[model samples]
Target: MRYSTYFLGCRVNQAEIEFFEDKLLKLGFEPSKDGKADIIIFNTCAVTNKAEKESYRLIRKIFATNPSSKIFITGCIVPLNKSFINQVKERIVQDNEVLKKNVDNIYIIPSTQKEKVIEIIEKEIIDKPHFDSLEISPKFIQRSKYYIKVQDGCNHFCTFCIIPYTRGRSRSKPVEQVVNEIKDICKNIGNNSDFGAEITLTGICLGEYGLDINTSLAKLLKAIIPYIPENARVRLSSMDLITLDEELIEVMASSPKICKFLHLSLQSGSNRILKLMKRNYTIEQYLDIIDKLYKTIPDLGISTDIIVGFPTETEEDFNLTLEAAKKAKFHRIHIFPFSFRPYTFAYQKMRHIKIDHEKVKEFEKKLMILSLEQSKNFITERQGKEYDILVEEGGYGYTHNFIRIKTNVDKVNCFVKVKIDGIEEEKGNFAVAKGLVTLPV
Candidate 1:
C-alpha cells in the first residue's frame, strides 16, 4: 500500500514524522506521488489557536479528498481534543454501534504512543511484511542531513504552555544510543542539498536533554564529536535560557563542529508577567546569559521566541519586552501572539482577561521591524569577513552564525569559505546577504 504523511509543528514533530516515513519505506510501502493514498498519517499541533484550527481544516480536506483511504490522526490534538476526537469518529464512521464494536476507518493515536504507529499498521493494515534485503538507512530521509531527537517532553510547566500536560515530564535517549545514531548516519555521508548538511539535535525542550539520564547536553556533545562527519556540523533546536550553563557554553565555544547559533526562549520581559507566566528568569538574567554567550562565543547568532499581547500584559509590559529585545540585538525573533490553550495554567487563571487583537498585531509588527534592523546590523558588521558555510541547493547557504547567503557556488552538501559581498536590497522579513565563494572547504 502507498502512504503519505503530514505534520504541522516544530522540528521534533518533523523528526517524528520522518521516522514514520522511513519505517513505512523499509516495509516496502511506496510514497504516494499524488494526494490520494491507501494510508495517510496526519500529525497535528495544538500549540496555538491558529494551529489547532489549521489541523482540523487539513484533516477535513484530507478526508474529503481521499474518501476511500484510511486516515490516522495523531499528535497533541488527538489526545487533548476529547469532544473533537469523538466528533471526528462519529463524523467519519457515522455508526455509534460500529464505533463501539471498534470498527472505523479513522484511527486516532495518542501522542504518547505515537511511536508505536508502525506496530498498529502491522496489526491492522499489513501482516507478514516482506523485509527489504538492502539495508535501510537509519538517518532521516527527507533532508540531506541527519535530524535526531535526543529527548522528548518538557519538565517546565510554564503557565502559557500545554506541552508539559500533553508531552509529559522530560526523558532522554541514552548518550551511547545518540552517539551510535550519529555514527551510523555519518558512515554514508552525502552531499548537502536544500536545507544544507548538518546534524540538528531536536527535542520538545532541547536544554532539558540530559537531566533524566544523569548526563548533560555537554557530555552528549563531547561523546558525539568524534562521530560527526568532518565537513558537517551540529545545531541544537531551541533551548531554554534557564537550562543553559557554563558547561554547555564551553562545549559550544571550544568546538568548531558545533554551529555558532543558539535559539533561547524569552517569553515575556516584564518581571511581573514573567513570574505570572512561570518563565523562571528575569530580563536581567536573560541578558546576562546573552552577554556571557556573546563574549565567550565570538560572532554568535542568538535568536529567541517572544509572545506578544499576552492577557494581563499592560502597555508598559509590552514596552519592557520591546526594550529588552532591542538591548539583546537578536539575530532573529520568532514573534507569536499569545495562544491560549485550555489545559494551561494561564487559560484557567487568566481566561477572563482579554487582549485587543489590534494590540497583538501592533506588537508583532514592532518586533518584525526590530528583527529586520538586527539582521541588517549583524550583516553590516560581517561585511568583508570570510566564513566557512555549508552549501546547499539554489546557490544558497547559511553562515556559522545563521546568516543566509546567496552565492555562485555549485557544490552542494559541503562546506565552503565565502566572503560577504553585499546585502539583498529588497525588503522582507529578514535580510539575505550576498556572498562570493572563495573555495570549497
Candidate 2:
C-alpha cells in the first residue's frame, strides 16, 4: 500500500513524522508523493488556536482533494484533552464533519498511542511484516542533518502552554539506544561525506532528558560523542534555563562536535509576567545563564523565544521585556503573540486582566521589528569571518554557529568554507557570503 505523512509544530513533531515515514517504508509500504494515497497520515498540532484551525482546514482540504484516500489524524490535536477534542468536534459537527460520514476510512489516534499507527495501518489497509521483524533505518531528507528524538513529553507545565497535557510526563530514550541509533545511521549512510554528518537531538524538554533514568543530558552527550564519526556534529534542541547546568555548558564548550548555538525559551522578560506564566527562571537568572554561556563558548549564537502581550502585561512590563531583549543581544528572537489556548492556566487568567486587542497587536508588531533588527545586527557582526557551512539544496546552508548563508557553490550536502561579505539584499534575515572553497570532512 502507498502512504503519505505530514506534520505541523516544532522539530519534535518533524522528528516523529520522519520516524513514522521510515518505519512505514521498512514495512513494505510505498510512498505516495503526488496525489491521493491509500493512506494519508497527518501528525497534527494544536499548540495555538491558529494551529488547531490550520489542522482542521488541512484535513478538510485533503479530503476534498482526495475523497477516496483513508485519513489518519494523530499528534497533539487528538485525544490529548477530551474537552479540547470535543470543542473541535463540535465545530466539525456544525460544518462538514467529513470523518463522521466515512468513519471506517478515518482514524483518530492519540499522541500517547502513536506507536499503534502501524498496527492500525496493518488492520485497516494491509498486513505485511510482523512487528518484531522490522529493522529500522535513517532516511534524513532535509539536507544531511539527521534529527534524533532523545526524549518524549514534558513534566513542566508552563501556564501558557498546553504541551505537557498533550504530551504527558517526560520520558527519555536509553543512552545506549540513542548511541546505537546515531551509529546505525552513520554506518548505513557509509563514509560517503554526502550524509550522516549532522545530528540534531530533539525532544519536548531536551534538558530534562535522562532524569527519570538517573542520567543527565550531559552524560548522554558525553557517551554519544565518542561513537559519532569525526566529521559528524550533534546539536541540542531548545532547553529551559533552569535545566541548563554548568556540567552541560562545560561539555558543549569542550566538544567540537557540538554546535556553538543555543536556543532558550525565555517566554517573557518581565519577571512578574514570567512568574504568572509559571516559568521557573527570573530575568536575572536568565541573563546570568546567557552571560555564562557567552563566557564559555566563543562566538555563540544565542537565540530565544519571546511571548508578547500576555494577560496582565502592562506597558512597563513590555518596556522591561524590550530592555531585556536589548541586554540579551539575542542572535535570533522568535516573537509570538500570546495565544489563548483552552484549558490552559493563562486562558482562564486572561479573563481577569486581558490586554486590549489593538495594544496586543501593537506589541506584536514592535517585538517583531526588534527581532528583525537583532537578527540583522547579529549577521552583520559575523561579516568578514570565515566559517564552515553544510551546503544544502538551492545553495543555501547554515554555519556551525547557526548563521544562515547563501553561496554560489553548486554542490549539496558538502562542507564549504565561506567568508561573509554582507547581508543578503531583500532576503533580510541571513548573510550573503562568498564561497571560499570546499572543505575536507
Candidate 3:
C-alpha cells in the first residue's frame, strides 16, 4: 500500500505525522511521492480561524487530486470542533446506509486517539493486522536532525489561546522513555555511518514536561546528557517564561551539545495586555531572564513570539510592546496578529474592547517591519564572525546560535565552519557566507 501524510500546525503535529509515517512504513506501506496514494492522512490544526480554513482548503485539494484514495482526517482540529466531527460521522453513516457503500474508507480520529490510527487502517483497509508488533527505531526525516516529543498537551489557559482546550492538561512521556528514545536515535545514527544526528525536544509546552511526574525538564536534561552520543546535539523547542529558571539555564550553558538558542513566547510586552491575556510573567521578569541567558551563554540567540493588536491594546500599549521589542533585540521575532478563537477567554472578554480592523492590520504591519529590521541588525552584528553550521540540503543551514546561512558548500548533513561575509539580500534576514572548513564531529 502507498500512503501520504500531511500535517499542519506546530512542531508537535510534525512529530506526530512523522511517527505515523514510521508506523505505516513498518506495516508495509510505501510512502507515495507523486501525490498519488492509496491512503491520504491529514493531521490538521485549529490554532486560529485561518489555520482551520487552510486545513479544509488543503483537504479539498487533496481529495480533488486523489479522489480514489481513502482519506483520514485527524488532529487538534477534530476534537475542538465537535460539530465538524459529528458532521463527518453523519456523512459516513449516510454513505454506508443510503448508498450501500463501505464508509470505512474515510476515517476520522481525534488527536487524543491518534495512537489507534494504525489499528483503524488495519481493520478498515486491510481487514486485519498485516504485521506483528515490532520495535521500530525513531527516524530522522530532516537529514541527521530528529525531533523527539518529550512532552504533550498544555496546562496553562491563557486568555487568548485555545491550545489547552485542544490538547487538554499537561502530560509528559516518562523520563526513562525519553532518554531511551534518544539513545535509540543515537544508535541508529551510529549504525547509518552517514553523519551524526541532532535531536530537538519538542512539545506543545516543553517546559511543562515532567510537571505531572516528580522530575522536571532540568532533571530530564541532566539524565539524558550522559546517554547521548558525544557528537549529537540537543535543542529545546519553544518554552514559556514561567517554566524557565536559572537551573535550566545553567544546564544548557554548561552543556556543549545543547544548542545556544532559546525561543520564548512573549505574546505581548505590555504588562497590562499581558495581564489581560492571563500571562503570569511581567515584562521585567521576561527581560531579566533574557539578560541572565545572554550573560550566561556567549553568542546566544534569543528568539521570541509576539502578538500584536491584542484586545484592549491601546496606542500606549502598542508603544510599550514596541519599546520592549527594541530593548530585547530578539534575533528572530515571530509576530502574530491577535486572532479571535472561539471558547477562549479573549474571545468572550475582548468583544467590548473594539479596535478597528484597519488599525490592527497597521499594527501588525509595523511590528513585522520592526522584526525584519531587528533580524537584519542581528545578521549584521555577526558579519565577520565564523560559526559551525549543520549543512543541510539545498546549500542552506543554521548555526548553533540559530543564524540561517546560505553557502555554496555541497556537503549535506555534515558540519562546516562558515565565515560570515555579507548579508544575503536587501532584507538581510539571512547571511551569505563562504565555507571556511569542514568541521569534524
Candidate 4:
C-alpha cells in the first residue's frame, strides 16, 4: 500500500502520524510523496474555526486527488467535532454502513494505554517502521529542530482551551521510552550527517511529564543528558509557569545543550481575567517566574501565549494584558482570540461575552507590532556579535538564544558562525546575519 499522510494542528499530532507511518511501513506500505496513494490519512486539528474549515477542505482535496484512495480522518478534530468528520466521511465513504465500519479503524484513541494505541496503529494503519530504524525527517518538518513528543494530553483545564476535551487527561510516555527514542534519534543523525541541532520535547503541557509515574522532568533531563550527543541541543516545549521548579531550572542553566529558550503560557495579564479563565497561576506569580528566568539566564529566549479577548474581558482588562506584555518584553509572543468550543467548562458555565471583533483584531495587530519591536530590540542589541547559525535550505538559520535567523545559503540544517547585521524586533521575529558561518565551498 502506498499512502500519503497529512497532519494538522500541534506537534503531538505530527508525532502520532510518524508513529503510524512507522507502523504502515512495517506492514509493507510505501509512503506517497504526491497525492497518488492507495490510502490517505488526515490527522486533523479543530483548534480554531478556520482550522476546522481548512481541515475539511484538505480532506475534500485528498478525496478529489485520489478518488480510489481510502480516506481516514483522525486526531483532535474527530473526537470533538463529529459533524465535521461525518460530513467528510459521507463525502468520501458514501454508504453509511460501510462508512461506519471503515471509520472504526480511524477513531481517536485514548492516551492512557500506549500498548493498545500502538497495537491499533501497527495492525490497522501501518505495522512496520517506515525506516529500518527511527530517522528524523527533514528540517521543514515544521516546529522544532528535532521533534520528540515526551508527553501528551492536558490536565490543566483552562476555561478557554479545548485541548483537554480533545486530547483527554495528561499522560506521559515512560521515561525509559523517551530516553530510548532520543538515543535512537541521535544515533540516526550521527549516521546520516553532521547536523548538531536541538531537540524540542513537546506536549500539551510539558511540565507534567512524570506525574503518573513518580519520575520528574528534572530527573528525566538528568538521565537523558549524559546519553545525548554533546552537539545536540535540547529544548523543552511550552510549559506552565506554575510548574517551573528550581530543580528544573538548575538542570537547564547547567546544561549547555539545553537552549535558553522557554515558552511559558500567560493567558492574561489581569488577575481578574485570570480568575475568569481558571488558569492556575495569577499574573503576579507569572511575572515573578518570568523575572526569575530572565535574571537567571540573561540570554534566555522567553516567549509566551496571550489571549486578546476572553469571555467577559473588559477594555481595562485587555489593557492590563498589553501593559504586562510590554513589561515582559517577551522574545516572542503568540496572540490568539478566544474561541468557544462545546463541552468545555467555559462553553457552558459563563455567558459568552460579546467582544468587538474589530477591537480584537486591532488588539492583535498592536501586540504583533509590539512583538516585532521586542524582537528588534534583541537583534539591535546583538548587532556585530558573532553567534552560531544553523544553515537551512535556500537560507542560513541562526538562533540568538531564542530568536531565529534565516540566511541565504545552500545547505540545510548545518550550524555555522555568523555576525548579527540587523534585527526585526517589532514582531520579535529575527535578525539579519552579516555573512555565512561556513567557509567558501
CA lDDT of every candidate:
0.81, 0.78, 0.77, 0.69
TM-score of 4: 0.86
- 1-441: candidate 4 lDDT, tens digit per residue: 787888888777776777666555645668887769876667778776667668767766666556555566676655534355455455544554544454543434333332344355455556533333233333222222666787878887887777787677878878887778777667655633346566778888889989988887888899888777655667778899887889998888888777778888888989999998889777788888888888887578788888886877778888899889878878678888877766677778764556678888887888888777777786677777766666666665657476576555666765666667674222233334345344421
Better of 1 and 3 by TM-score: 1
Model 2 residue runs over 4 Å out of place are 82-94, 97-99, 128-143, 194-196, 426-441
What's the TM-score of each model vs. the native? 0.92, 0.93, 0.90, 0.86
lDDT by residue for model 2 over 1-441, one digit each (tens)?
788888888888888887888877766778887957888889889887788889888877776666677777887777576556655445543455555565456667778777778777766567654473223565634337777888888888888887877888999988888887878777754666655357899998999999999999999999988877755678888888888888899999998889999899888879999999889889999998888888989888888888887888989999898888888888677777777876678777675765687888788778777777877788787778888787888887788778788888787877777888777643432234444444534
lDDT of 1 by residue, 96-190 (tens): 45333443577888777775577768767887553432233465353556678888888888999878766778899898878877777776574
Q: Could you give me the TM-score of model 2 versus the true structure?
A: 0.93
Candidates arranged by TM-score, highest first: 2, 1, 3, 4
- Model 1 scores a C-alpha lDDT of 0.81
Clashes of each: 2, 0, 0, 24
> Which window of 10 residues has the lowest lDDT sum in candidate 3?
91-100
